[model samples]
Target chain A: MTSLGGDRSIGRLLASLALAVGGMGAGAVWAPSASAKPPAPAAFCQTYPDSKSCTTGFAECATCHTTAPARNAFGAQLSERLAPGTPRPLSDQAFVSALPSALKMIEGLDADEDGFSNLAEIRAGTRLASAESFPKVMACAPDQASKSGDGRWNVCGYDPNYAFRKISLDFCGRSPNRAEAEAFRKIKGEAAQKAALGEALDRCLVSKYWLGSNGVVWNLANAKIRPAFVIKSGANPGPVPLGDYDDDYNLFTWAHSGDRDVRDVLKAQYFVRRVSDDPVKLEIIPEEEVKKRGRATAQPVPADKRAGLVTTRWFAASNTMFTAIPRTTAAQAYRAYLGWDIAKMQGLLPVSDEPHDYDRKGVGAPECAVCHTTLDPLTYPFTRYNGIGGGYTYDDDRLKAYIRGDGPNVVNAPKSGIILGKPVKDLVEWADVAANSDPFAMNVVRDYWKVIVGREPEVQDEEEFSRLWRGLKDPARYNYRVERMLHDLVLTTAYGRP
Target chain B: MTRTAFIPALALVAAMFAAGCSSLPSAGSEPAQVASIDPKVKFKDGDRYLGDLARALNMPRETVCKELGRYDCFSDAFRIVLGGVEAPNLTVHTPLEEAALTAPIALDRAALHVCTSRVRMDREDPANAVLYRASASGRPDKAWMETTSNELYGVLLNRDPTKAERARLVGFYKDVATEQGKPNPDAASDWVTLSCFALASSLESIFY
Candidate 1:
């Protein structure tokens, strides 16, 4: 048999073989009991004095005899004396000792019947009423229901079947701020307006309170989209519904821990205009929506070799790696290029048998190495961060903990591999490090900005994107700018593209 | 082609003008042909629809169809332009493009009035309800309705605003509740149709 090494990666096979050796040691030394023989031995031992062989004393003559009935009877009596102490009484030890050949006879009858001697059972806790009499086992609770309705918000109520899909929003019941409400109240012939306002108020009340009541149900149904990374961390990361365009808008609750980041993207501050300002003005310009419209292009990897081009491996699900939004061409390009780099870092480029020495949090190195031996290009961009706050914050500790080799708790682990030589604790730091070292970061931002806003990133625009990415390096801008960024993104030509 | 485009634009403007003056579509008079209008027809989305449906049913739009379902692109557009609700089932009596087209004009208008009046009153403005004289005949157990409205309002207020569109559908049966409350024989006659409309539109009655 081939010998196995004791490396942590190879420990399971080694442990199994060692257990086999232990089994053989017990089987070789065990012996049978004297009580197993027939009572005919009694006749033989009793007749010994009458037979020619009995001419000598029976104890002396019986040395060559295989069958001795009187000796067998003595052996049984001696064995009884050695039986283990129980709650009940047994014959006296003195009576047992009076039998001839007591020591040898008692040794043949094994108590406890474990491969080990009775003394060993006493030492080991294995000795009990009987081996068949099982120790009590505790029963486990039933599987936790995802949709338990005992929640304050209808959204919190559990439904194992509803997957995250079809989110919607309405401003019903929440009249505009005081100024707006007062202004509307002043319209004299405003019956229509008043009615409209009432409707809006009702919509607001429902959307704000009841929209996501079934989120747990939806999440449970679509387990794959259940934000696996967030769930593993033991934190209440809020909920995500998984379905494609079943509802108007994707509704996320304010109860979300990542609300700040989401708000930043919406640019929900006073400075930014409401999305509903000019309803008729909304138009989709598809061609102008190309990724990174005017941004610098990412270094291209050949198509055939581009399979391993994804850079952010923080969260990949269903075996497909991606980003939340790869709105820009540069972002997409960098994703492709970095994906290949990651594959190389993991020794997938040379197609070697050796595993990559990635940190404990990485996904593709050892975890995915067994499947895809070669590099593959990234097909999508990294737009959404699946970690604790908002999207990607770029914190060093968080990033390190995520892609370090061992998986982070399910909440923070990135399914894809990390960029080589870049400093990434969280998404924000990654942006900073990318700005300084990976020219690709700048490219991604520029392209994404242009795509989202439907306008080319001018000097000011480029400067702002760079500044946002850089300022966020300190992590302050991570969750705060989601609203602004989202508002800006939707305003871009890139946002309208397929 | 330009002339044809101009004609459609002119028609739309004319339609709007006509709509503003209450030169309403002859309820049920138009043949019930299922012509496919743009899904984005103005006033068909979420709160607008709920509001109109509530008004037609003589109930509070806000208190009834409080949650507006998801506003699709079309629905959003419809919401922005919606003017008022009419009880069209009383006049127009044919199943046209969608259900609304099939309704009679008088019935639709009546429902719309009721919804608007009641909703305006429900919004912490008891004076509005008093002014509209929108009292339920036979003294609808005012306390029960009040309690129900309060419960619904609390649920509505605390809910995430984004889901307002979808959740508003819970008021689908507002007409039924209002009909049960109304003491007037004339109003009660039309209550069943109004209630059916409300029930059909609610999120709870539909998707939920």
Candidate 2:
């Protein structure tokens, strides 16, 4: 968020000054001002790097602003308590430096009035801003867990019997038979039972039902690829038949299945081809040979410039669709891959001097400036890629054609852009930084967590959820293999209990 | 005719369909007119229910149930209501978060349809029957009802039905006999079909 502090505009500095001396408008409820300085998230994460919200390298916007600029309960308290007498609208440098002390002042306060102190909630990885969310270490105390009435289900902790049935259906696409469940229950010990469950999961992980076309992995890509049959060109062709999104789904399923590194979905330079459906095998179409598929849906981005799904022909065709400045393309990538939605004012990290009214979109006004500042810089790298009717290739001249319609100023939009505050020259570098970051791993693991658990992780499940996502980032633990992560996932108390 | 003989829950579900079917265009007559939006069910678990039920019953998935014995149950007539997708054509990428208003009607419509179909097939080939083992004449006995309840639970839920569960199924069979006012041969087929329908639409069956 320090990038937002770099704004050199005199009008904004005056507004920050006016908001500061006016008591932040924090003392009284106020309408959310758009694009409050983006540097606050960075400073918040820096102070509490171990915080659960910062596990992905950025604190949630909910931590401070409700819709940002509009402070939530804790944020309101933080605003009043921050650097008590310092001029309101602390400069980026001043705000970053004073935040730790402001946080300390309110540690004892129950901001949400949930009966838990702010410090306790933060340390426990629960949301301090919401009364409905708090730590639950005692929710399933060891002595109260695992013991049962039916011997068929455990009420409070991981129950092998429950998980066996759940895993069979989730991965294998059908429930286990009575004989199989009976055999699983009869295993002599917990370790042996888990081993048997793991073996069963190992077998299911590769089943045609999990990895095949229209299977689990394939369906996960539906939102990411947003496949539409009208423009679909491959096996099940649509009437218009534009660039096929089967290519996008193929790369997604390939990168996520088996021992493959999950990061390849965003960082790989090669294409994955589905060679068979009956057995569900996907082989890499080496970058050198990517041209053989030479159909209308073929990869048009040269190998060295490719960055997995972000650079796909279908991704460009669907999202960019001939915009001179491709904010929609960047926003879709950020949301689809990083789990951050920009439309809802999420993941806003305003870059300084951005939204320079690029393509003359009239986004420099305060209300429009709030989001476009972060969005426009993000869109810059995408300007080199042609969309939809532009032959689906990357070139520096792609923006020149739009200049005729967007005005002569459109040609001046730069290629360099900032991602999460780190500057990158092009999409490949942007993707590389994004793929290797903590948030990338968190988002990847969350996909499986939601599908398997049938819900998003709750406050009570935070500890196990935190451990599992962190494990995905550790080299020796899961090593980025989604299959290995699923083995642990099936064993979690959250998954197995009830 | 079989719809009128099931448990009260299934019967209530059946009554809704009784009204719904009367409004539908008859087969081989003309295409029905569109009334509103149709969002498709595109996810795996969303479409899994009917297919898994067919597998458990050991019938060809498509033949398990059909609307008017023509359109397949899962894919055609009930596709939109049952969470099937109508994508690209309508841009519905996500499946329904909760079951539709007609979900219960569709559940019994498919379950009772399949159960009745299975009993008919078993009657035609008693020795090779999957459910019912072999056709019996007259009302189903307590032991046979208990066995059928366990079989349904075993195939659908992967565990044996509890004693209370088995007792409920047997009691439902006696209720079916009483509903007829006197001993009747069709009550036996009706009992078997209702027993299967109750388990097929149970909370456990629909969820897991």
Candidate 3:
């Protein structure tokens, strides 16, 4: 598996260098001002020949014209820097002459070489700059706006008139008002574009195999939530990156393959056996004999890594490597076994726990709430989606109804799902928890802001919650609120904390 | 000549234009006559006094031409009727007054039945009325257009309160068509109603 794609670490280095160098010129050039003079307001009005009804108002003109030029400039720069061989620059006068043409040009520039254009990257704000980058882009679009076509871009399921898609999708129709849309676009570019595409790809991969639909949907709530069922059932499951998809199955498949060169089964054994405190009472199974009896039963880890296979039945089990090793003192044994100090191993425990299906037996282990309680409750209001990437599985009837406008009402509707012992509901309720009961969402925000701004926010930053709420409430303030939050967090004393 | 002579003339022209003539205007006429008419209860074969009035008033061919969202009000017709109406002084005169100036001979009350289309057609022409074209274009000088469109809107209101378009056009003319800086109630209703219709249409286009 390691030899499948040899280390291309050099590619990552070059890309990271390009981003750092490009930052100096790119950031300064495309920055749009809320107060800037709008371009071509009167020109748009002139389309109506007989009546100047659409013309003669500066405010009205300002609505559409504010960002056209800026968007054009952004496109121009992107074209020149990313794909010089392309005939047109994004911000060229020719590009501006017809918005559709400009979008077409941007769509053609596959900066990531993942069969998707940078325009898709910009829209989803993912790093699909290369084949490796494809995973991030795939993880982002999933069910909504999934790309399909032999050689061209054609998205299904996403509304063409969706505000975000309006500028990036069609480009031919009337453009979004600059005041409202530009800021959001800039914010997206800044956050997603900063990372090397490969790194972004890697993160996307990690998210897919581990986080699954619940995680992806949570991430997508910041952009838009199309349907709760989309995530819940693992329906279309939009554009998750190929690398993440690949990584997720590769690790699992390797463990079960019975190949000695591969160390995956050993890895699982290390995770399970090392976490036990009382090894003497635990059961341990060897992989060699288990593979020999593979057809009849689940396999077990090799005896070398297993601590007490003969004395106790408590052990780990995998579909290939080991399924489970149940012992009377399994819980106690699990706590005592650790290669590293218990305190240092706590962080690793979050990902290391074997997924338990509470449904399989009458008694079920604690689930998402164990780690996500604080995060889930706090961040609930910020978004209202779960079971993101592969969680949504829709039947034929639901699909037909959705297209016909007779589908389930996913937006602002009550939801019921068991994450732990309790059934969590809507975004508002989620927000309530985040604001009051949960601190993880805020911590995530804090961490994200710190990374963005190069510093942490102070206790006084609590007041920013209201400010952020107010700004987000006014759709016009999207770009500003995000930037201000970044600026405040970075420039403050609190953000600098480790 | 007796008033009956005009009946044949009205019928002949209605037939020529393929307009409904029988049910609309009464064949017998007295030059200064005024009769209350129901807007609803479609006069399937009613007289299309519009063409007669258009011809009588010499309304421009362009004004009578149809376009998407173009022929909304009397002022819109005024533009086509009056050649090169100024934008600044659009509200200076009413649709009737502007029509009076453009086609003085058509002002006789006997021609009122035929005048509706003429006025509407004139409003459609950019040349005839000042405020009209601007108003339709969503321009700043829409006030005058609002005023005239409103007045014509008034005519529609009075003729048939329950007419199919009465409520819709009335709502838009009142709420949306009028100019921003200044508001005129008389024409405001119609102007706003039309403007609202335009807005609603735009929203529908984007969403649906």
Candidate 4:
């Protein structure tokens, strides 16, 4: 007969997505007129240095180009104001210098016509180009504040008591039993209670429900790995298991747990084996042992060729499949590990005069060229890594081996490619560039943010989200340990409040 | 306004955004106060919900909720609807972003299953029973329902029911008595079973 108490919003749950909220930043030294000039993304941040979109150091490509070369309403407006009468394809310097004025010129206009002006949208961290992606107006003010049960709850701020209940359920995977709940309520000082929450997290972080086979952290890899049980090789091997994804899961779990380095998920040269499931223990397996013990479906990418989860046999087999240009493979690695989705027009760093369409996939057409310019070159390094037929191994002849079906033009695929507007010699360098990138830190932090906070960082959450990710990459704070970062995260006003 | 603006907070220290990757969102114009109402991050997933029930009932998890007495509800029947992932087999890498419509129905079925299963076990051996402390052989008194509510609430919610909640359960007992017409010997058992269902499937029981 008791009332069931819960809100009715169906928001992101259990951290299963890689939502493409892309912003780009790359190494210095790319000249003003470098390849694919008019870095609209970069110039955007320079113009609106305090724009919410600039928090991560760049704006999403969607802010200007619908799919690069095709400007959105905001970009179209900016185009009209940018260096008027200066011929098409203005120099990067001209565009960069003129960007502020162009942005200011259009500030009064409602680019998306969502009522909010372009400047307001940019400041609100809403999409200036998309009508649906606008900031929510404050509907309720503090004077009209909703009342709490006992009047003791900080209705306007982080409530440690509420946060303790949340942390217990989220991390420990259950509500505290009556005795434990009562004991938490009995803690005297707020600092002591907050300290108790940390201790509880320490205990729960090691629980089986968190690190076990189907545990919360393990499932966080589901969207990234996209495991298919039918073709799975290890643990619950399918009928025709080709390769095991558990290795991929093990490496992911290891990278995110304990005193581990999260960068290892992208930069690890060694494979991790889940040594124990209960009180989960994962250790790096030496290359020699992995090689000698290799079954046909064993982790096929040799230690020297491995790039953490990106180079896992299952990752290559599932995403790359069979293709002359393994654009899907490269895109998945970028989307999954780096949190950029080219499909969503995110993380675009267009290489100039690109998408040679070497395999003749018709990507040279203007409609396709915008993203392909960035995507095709981004895919070049992945082309050298074979798909299903090649056991996902690195092969100099991978392109040549596919020429029979894809034609000899496939062999023209480049071994070097571009990532974040910077050139990389190969996928190994590509992973390294991505792993150390600011986006990688932001993306990793965003993953946990979404998991614990139960939603994407809203305009209100930007400051907290920014601090958490920044601290994650800061050696002085967390030293890149996700566990350490989480300590600061649970303390964030966003996570602790509501 | 921005909900945390009124709170004592860490000063916003913007990381120079040390470059080398595509990113987004910088400190934009402080638009306005973000509403005090943050989105509700509620709803326990199936694993946690079912696990909580199993732990509270002092029953083996396998006996908690079996669809058709065979399949595990969390792993099978209500798996996806209740927020358990079945990846690599179904490609459902993540749980549904929101609780599915059938989620509440699945939750009810799972909760009822565990509650009834516990009642059945306790009825078979009342001397060693964890619930139904008093015999459910006849019409229950108000005092008995109060004790039952506390036990049920403590077992599932880990806290005693409020006075209002106790009053509601007691009111429901009268309705159960009327449905019996005659003083059915099974009225007390039926009342206990129904009361357990109400508490086990309550929203507070399901969501965090």
Candidate 5:
């Protein structure tokens, strides 16, 4: 058996193997020479920056290569310099030595021709390879002061009326009513108008309309699963309408209301459900009653089995594959809470001979071990939570029985699992671990930014994104209160712009 | 008519009316469809559109709902599908093409079915008629028509119409009335159609 070192090693092996196998049976005899060896890893900019290090936010390998060997313009340029001779692989040492000259060669070049040089683009945290991803160059006169109504500044500059419209529409799910619009127009100066707009935003954030059917907050939260509420169980089982799971929306609305910390979405002890007679009124109950009364009854889940939304029926139903504790549940939780995909991160880890039962015999071979080693362990703690039953169960007896009869031949089936490289004993611990993690904070900031800014947070927006992330997690500032974070987001220069 | 023939006929009528209105352009000239609005521009979605229209027109929510049968009529006209599944209601983002293509036709049909019905009901009651009231002399004049247009624009578009826009609309009303011939008892009906077209087809009415 051969050991697969990692993604880079496997990629190199595949490249060499392709070359070796190409000339075979074509009257060309190929022999393995003693001097021949697998090429060393490319010294990617992040791992081996030249004399001037790649700037902040220029950290991921994806910055150059969309994925290795599939080079973006910047990556293509580097490839041309480092492996110019018939596309031969460059060793790590060779790559490191070649990088300095390669970097100097492309310093002033505008690869994508979006008006910024490669070095300037890298420093500005803009993508050098994509014209669409370059830094936004707003045309402004030298004398055009910030926030002035000169009309010289491009849409990137603050516009009071535009910002007001955005705030009302994004936060309240409607255009400003006539009274509000007139009031905004009545304000005399830009400063006064901005102050009034801020006040209006505060009111909109707490208004019942913000928590209503068309609310932006509700829409953003719902985008994760967009649960169908009804499921066709399997052959002959018929349709199962989990109308009770509508409580998930109610719980989200409640958690975001008033001074409630949005983090309570993961940490709240109780869940909320709409009153049957009046769909508007909601009742909160402890988590323990969820199993006995169903999620529609607004009940509490037991402490050991609870992890806020993760253990909720809607989340489980939507994310899980039927009849088992699917790794999909863990992956969704990671994405929803931590803003990272385990599958995407697989390339960063070295391959192992670890066993993962779900993978077919040859599928989990060393070449694919990078993802399973992390993903399988992460899903171990979730085994206690039954997928089809629509509730949590501490008794692993059923899980053990399922594993024996029908589940994967997962070795060691540890009681504890790992998250973001830290060990978590159970689903509850997983929530706590995630709730306090930086990625979770960043994810919250990123989601809210996307909704408020009306666009994806690009690398050009990284500085502001980091600032917002820090402000949100900072107890002295927003203290993880989502309302305050949202307020701060609207006040940011980016949100105020057209 | 066969379903295929009916669809093409409807498309032809829609295209003709859209071209007739110089203010409203064809959908083909619009940019590529985006899943989200620019926030700086773009019209409100269905919920806000219906809710605001109900408020501006002083029409009851139930009356609007009754006229526009839930998902089959107006909602289907502007609905968006994602990955072969219909997105949740109120989450559908109408691109410019869909809005331009569907809004005029849907609003016109709605005006014919719903607004015309409301005007007929108002004519009988006279007391609760928000659009038109019984005149002492029972005569339609330029002043009354201008006041009516201003009131409609104020309520629907939330801004007074420009001098040029108001003149164009007034000319449109006269043209439409002449086409129907003089002493047309349906002059009020003509005004109703003009009001609906002016308000619903205007960029201000469509975009926030």
Candidate 6:
């Protein structure tokens, strides 16, 4: 149940701060005072040039700093050395005078006390603030050393040839041919063999089998919910086949195949569809037009209306029930997108004392409000979107009927909602909040880690997991490119070992 | 009746009895001492196994699938039942019923049909000239059998057979040839048939 382990407590604390300071705006709350004497930018920048505060990239200071003045362990250490204030242009002399002391102070400190020194963590591109984040240094058993004194087999515990075969089957969905196997075996020396194996993995990632058949992209999507054209029929009519589901699959395949940013899954303004021809070409359609096409044709929706996979017809159909205001839809979104299941109260949101009833009373009552406080508000924006039967519509009357009770005037129905304690007027704002949230990135990393390692990442893996997450978020490195993430994963000790 | 006529009838009956006895093993005799080959290889599921088979045989997957009766051979034979509601790519995660009653039966039937067809198609083709030569060499010697066994092992198991294994398989081939009779014109085809069966039904061939 505790997937994140002891780090969950720390994560909970950050979540609380994020929610409590939600209204103040992330930048406003985190930004240091402008009037205070600014730090020597050149000194900090020169030392940790790749740090977000020092660079203009996706992974910035805010990644670790939930609030700037109140920094996390990593941020605090940096702030102490660099001088606590907003970064500003400083003279070279002033920068040089401050650089040595700050660097010296953090040199030997294990800020999070995860055993790894701050310098080691920084050099390894691991998080210094989180005890959970550290490099995994694998130790080999003494008996495993080869006669030739090559420790490769000792570390990996798998014959390079067998490892290559397994990697090919797992990544490419088939075994290597005789020629391919021979070519791989012909490579002499452990280093050369390892390099060749890595190159083979890279080639497999782009193979037709990986792209079309048993590829990671499709498997990742399937793991969430099987891409279905129709749900089974019982008392209610089965959800009809919407061409959009196939479009969703094609879009995912295209993104991953192209090695494009995977964050576009939640943030892209267009959906891709393959044209029916001898040599098919994928076309991107706008969100509004896609909605108008319904299940009749494949097209893109307008940028503002699109919410990546969340707004897809298949997603809505799979998650929603017959009822108009499908609370399950919101719950699924929270679990899938944010990586926290509301039913389990994983986020540990505060409970307030109030009376209970189904008519607003239940939502506000102290006992019921424990979960509904977050659940109801989170579901408010979803009321605009109807269930499977309604398809994808923005009709106000349909929205009203859905939120209100079917028979009567339900004045108690929520008119607005909050996401991670941030107020959202409607689903668009909700999507924006969900898309840019830290939980979104963390969830993605968690999912990918599971796919690559074939197991749920334990608490011990939090440091490496965070590094992967940071890389995905950092536009400078991978930037939400899943292929790059997969490449990184294949090269990990976990992937190489049994 | 004449004594000559009676003697001729007795001789004809003796010849028939002798032929029948030759076909059957002697009473209290042990079964043919066939070598037991256990590669300790586990079975791959339908898709992977079929893909491997097609690649190793240099045949199109569609042809192999069709010859094996498609789903019956690949899915039902392997117990990968694709129910009406099941997705095509949804892998059945249950452990394969390697010891199930029907497993051997199904494997035998499919391997016999496919391997026979593959041998028949390749026998006359120049591409399989080595296989044809080995089969048609009248009587296989130790060196030839060893070479053939190694080649077959490479194709099926992706490795060379050990000296003991090659010797055992060659002994099997010799026994098969001797049982078919020396003057049998179909001796080559029968040898190839048994060899194909051995490769196809092998633990190495069935498993990864």
- The top-ranked prediction according to lDDT is 4
Best by TM-score: 4
lDDT by residue for model 2 over A1-498, one digit each (tens)?
000111011111121222232222222322234447545655776788775554444455567666667888899888887877988667767777789999989889999898988887766556667787775443443433433432334555566887887888889887777778788878979899899999999989888888987777887777888888888886788888778887888999988997888888888888888998878889987766778666676788888888889889889988998798889999999888877667877555566566787588898899887777667888898888888858778888777888778998888888878676567899999898778765577678777877787666654455677788789988999988888889999998768766
Question: What are the per-residue Cα lDDT tens digits for candidate 5 across A1-498?
Answer: 111111111111222222222222111222221122112122334443431113221244454666543678887776666646634555545656676677677878888787777776655545567786554433343343332343322353556776787787666656666777777777889678867887878877765556664355555566554545344221222256442445566677766666677676777667776554222355676545555674433223465566677776666666653544467888777766766665664212221233355423343544444456556666777776655454434455535545554545433465576655555787778788778765677778777775567455553354576688778788998788788777767766667765
For all candidates, what are the clash counts? 155, 9, 104, 23, 6, 14
Each model's Cα RMSD: 30.1, 10.6, 30.1, 11.3, 10.3, 15.5
Q: After superposition, how far is residue A311 of candidate 5 from its true place, in Å?
A: 1.8
Q: Specify the CAPRI tier of model 2.
A: incorrect
Candidate 4 residue lDDT tens string, A51-147: 6666545565566766556788888898888899998777777878888887888999999888888887777667777877766643334453444
In the range B7-122, model 5's lDDT, one tens digit per residue, is 34334434444544454222233322211111335455555555566676677644653444554233454433211123233433222333345455555555444445556666
lDDT values of the candidates? 0.27, 0.71, 0.27, 0.72, 0.55, 0.54
Model 1 residue runs over 4 Å out of place are: A1-225, A228-480, A485-498, B1-184, B188-208
**Which 10-residue window of candidate 2 chain A scores lowest in summed lDDT?**
A1-10
Once fitted onto the true fold, the runs of candidate 3 whose alpha carbons sit more than 4 angstroms away are A1-351, A356-498, B1-146, B150-196, B199-208
TM-score of each: 0.24, 0.81, 0.17, 0.83, 0.75, 0.62
**Candidate 5, pairs of clashing residues:** A286-A299, A286-A300, A287-A300, A287-A301, A288-A300, A288-A301
lDDT (10s digit) by residue, model 3, range B1-208: 1234333433333342222122322222312112111001111000112222233245543443232336522334434343212212232211122233443222112133224344344457858632233445454353454354444433321111223233333333333323343454334323432332222122111121
What ranges in model 4 sit over 4 Å off?
A: A1-50, A54-122, A127-149, B1-36, B135-139, B180-184
* lDDT score of residue A320 within candidate 3: 8
- Tens digit of per-residue lDDT, candidate 3, span A263-351: 22123332111122121111223455444642212223233323221111111111001111111122222122111111211111121
Residue-level lDDT for A280 in candidate 6: 33
Highest DockQ scorer:
4
- Candidate 5: C-alpha RMSD to true structure equals 10.3
What DockQ does candidate 3 score?
A: 0.00
- Comparison by DockQ, 4 against 5, better one: 4
State residue A206's C-alpha deviation in candidate 1, in Å.
17
